[model samples]
Target: MNLAKNRNEIDPKFKWDIEKIYADTETWNKEFQEIKTLAPKLKEYEGKLNNAETLYEFLQLEEKVSRKLYLLLIYAFLKSDEDTTQNQYQALKSKIQAFAAEFGSYVSFMNPELLSLPEGTMEKFLEEKEELKLYKFMIEDLLRNKPHVLSQKEEALLASAEDIFGAPQNIYNIFSNADLKFPQITNEEGEKVDFTESSYFKYIISKNRDVRKEAFEALFGTYESFKNTIATSLTASTKKFAFMAKTKKFNSSIEYALSPLNIPVSVYDNLIETINNNLNLLHRYVDVKKKLLGVDELHMYDLYVPVIDVPDMHIEFQEGVDMVKEGIKPLGEEYLNIFQEGIDNRWIDVYENKGKRNGAYSWGSYDTMPYVLLNYNFKYNDVSTLAHEMGHSLHSYYSRKEQPFVYSNYTLFCAEVASTVNECLLINDRISKETDKKKKLYYINEQLEQIRGTVFRQTMFAEFERETHKLIDAGTPLTSEELNDIYYNLNKKYYGDKMVIDDLIKVEWARIPHFYRDFYVYQYSTGYSAAMSFTSAILRDGEEAVERYKGFLKSGGSDYSINILKKAGVDMTTTKPVQDTMDRFKELLDMLEAEL
Candidate 1:
């Protein structure tokens, strides 16, 4: 295989043409200077929100500054992800951070001023000014936090703590993706292959136990070595959260987390309970793995071997595009057309290369067409991955086409729904079209793997996060030992019965970067459950469901996220969607058992 390369010759597919962001560096520099000059003028509105004209003027200038700042940051990330070692890209990253900090210095008064208004004055302001009505939600989001909104001096003090709070994510990224190393393993054919960070999952899923053992030991052993340092950084991150929540008068860290998105604690509880009850089915799947592999006992590392051999699932690039198109057809013609437009244009960079960003994502700006970056290997999983990323691209296209500037960007909480819906539909299509018994079984198990990884495993991570934060909120110190104990115990609860709950698994919490991000992992579980319900609804109702889902894609951040999801038909406030998804897991287990 000629494969791909990004070192000497950049694969056209792996490299995004960021020239679209701004024709070149010269244009970006010009815009950067213009935005910097505009920043100082924002101070003109420091004490003047009572005057609509002044407020509107400040907002317009602020918008321009923000748009330019966005362009700079996107370019820096694109360039950095392409190759993190580039000094040019690294310099821009720091420069942008400094500019953001400086910009914060100027506009720090905006939120404070809004909260200072008389209780009902903002409602009247929205009614009076046509321009202000467009920003009504933005204004009220501040007022909603008036109780927690701090004074200017205190807010400034907290704002200066950004880097301290960001330390965990930074440290984890450096160690995991860019720094960690794994030992070489001898495969069944006696060929020695060294493991890279990108190869961790691939190696773990190998049919050979020796390969799995070597990879698991090497990968996690590295983490265990650095456990102390990683634990300290994570503990400090928890302190940052504890401090913020306490100062803001929230009862607990979980309350502070759910309050932002208007989600309830019960939603989290329901997810954990639903998964806990379904573990017998999951354990049954693990038992099947043990029998198939003929292992006396199953370990965590042996979980990924393919039980059913899938034949000729090797799709060419064009065939992958066609499959994604057919799978997403139910999303209606308009949504599909916009998605097709992105594919037809050079909006996607679709192959792997050395030093290219790991994993995949759909990204673009309000000013640009939605674009996807993928590291394609043409495996069956790649086909599903294509559908997943395109789900996000199409969502971005529709959202940008419909929503105004302020509302154009949606929250991370709703981000996975569009992507996962596409994945589910693609899997359903593959299972329907592929007729060979073994191949179909392989596809079914692949779908099962999605539930195992995304729904069940992530919920476990969510539980761990919630538990750790609760400890922190209670004024408990989160030492490395304490974190290890909490993490190892949860590992036992989730995977203990079937697979050995190795003591080494305790270090896993130290390495998980998501713990630094308050209340993020649960979204994967909630989003997967919601997508399953949406997928079933679309299949049964067809056009009407497609139209509503399309409406959801276009909604962007125009409405509250909870309200937006409800309009699209799945509500997170209740547990119906999650229960339905868990039932599907049971059904899938039955099908697999029949095959056995």
Candidate 2:
């Protein structure tokens, strides 16, 4: 697959119309300056938050400025992601970062001040001003953290330290995506290809064992060369989280991270425990792979390659769009119209370019169309990715339309549920309609892999994160050697004795960018489980389930994540969701084994 070396060479229709965010750079600059000017004015309302009218006024002004600031910031961030090397957009993005820190510092007093108000003042304010009802949840959520709220000066210091706190992640992004280079490897066709971050997935899943093995070795080998550097980078990030947690008086970094979402550490522990108890199922799946691949032993590189040889299912971009449209018909015509409009308009950046960001994501502000970025390779998984990201976009669209701006942005805990549910709908629809035995088998295999990747694999990642943070909290230094050993042992525990755990796979943790975000990967597991619950409901109850699912999307941050999911019929606070997900995986594995 040859990639375009220049962005201009790609068709305009294939690229996202990010220009629609602003008419031009001048217009963006105009708004940028306006935000800078408007931000500091919030200081005038600093001490006056004690008064009902002044508090209402300050909240209104804060929302207005925040909406505009996000629009400008999202545009610059997406533009910079398109080509990280572009100095112009890079500078634009840096300017927004600095402005954001300054703005955050200026507004930092609001929460602490609001928390300091007389015990019943906020409730009285809410009663006196009907207009303030729009912000009732926002105010209450802030006050709920009264114990964690620092003094105004301390809050300002933490706000000002935002950029300094995020330096490690910034550095990792630069080194991983911009500076690092992979060695050239020979492909199946005997052509030498430069292994890049975007190309890593393509090579790793190759049908040819030699090609993928070489690619895997070359990629992790490059990471191994910088093992110490990457280890130190990750350590700094972990320490940053620990420092913040201690300063905020939380019991643990993981606790601090999940508190905002109102999730308990037990939920995290439940996932790890469930996955540990079910390792034998994963081992069984691996054993199936070893037997089907007819290998004496299964290595890490061989796990991704398909066991059943079905004809290649190459889907073009428009075909993928059409297929996705049909797959989601269960969501009703109104939902279909929104999906079609996003695809018809330039809501998605469809194809990869020279320096565009790798991977796919859906992002936007409350005031704008939800935008999706894709490095589309026209494969079956690309279509699945389209379905997944469109789930996120549609969730944003509904939330923005139904809820106030303050509650429009849902937490990551619920965000993944929306996306994974889409993937479930797509996969189930495809499997039901596929007539050819081989293709049906292929779809079954895909479902199996989905459970493996999203459920089992992510749980492994979540456990790694939990253990590493605990180790750091316990005063163990995370040097390269120690990190590698801990990771290798985790691999052994997860994989059991079913497969050969290669030394190269031990360094895999060095390449994961998600680790920097701290306790984030677990959401993928929980979301997938919740999605399975939704899929079962839709299948069982028909339109009733559809309405309930849509209600969950529109609920947004209007309530807590678990409550939102409960309304959708899944209670995540217990061990039931994880068990249900494991049961679903077992059912799928049974079908695949019977077919084999």
Instruction: List TM-scores for all candidates, in order.
Output: 0.89, 0.87
lDDT of 1 by residue, 20-89 (tens): 8878667877888888887898887888877777777788888888777888878767766666657777
Of candidate 1, the 10-residue stretch with the lowest lDDT total is 6-15
Q: Write the per-residue lDDT of candidate 2 for residues 434-514, one digit (tens) a residue.
A: 887788788888888888999888999999899889988877788999889888999998887989999999999998999
Off by over 4 Å in 2: 1-37, 73-102, 153-203, 208-236, 314-318, 344-359, 374-377, 476-482
In candidate 1, which residue ranges exceed 4 Å CA deviation?
Answer: 5-21, 24-26, 71-102, 165-199, 218-233, 309-312, 352-358, 477-482
* Alpha-carbon RMSD of each model: 3.4, 3.7
lDDT of 1: 0.80
Top model by lDDT, which number? 2
Clashes of each: 0, 0
Which 10 residues in a row give candidate 2 its minimum summed lDDT?
A: 1-10
Compared with the true structure, all predictions reach lDDT values of 0.80, 0.88
For model 2, state the Cα shift of residue 492 in Å.
2.1
lDDT for position 198 in model 2: 81
Error of 2 at 371 (Å): 3.2
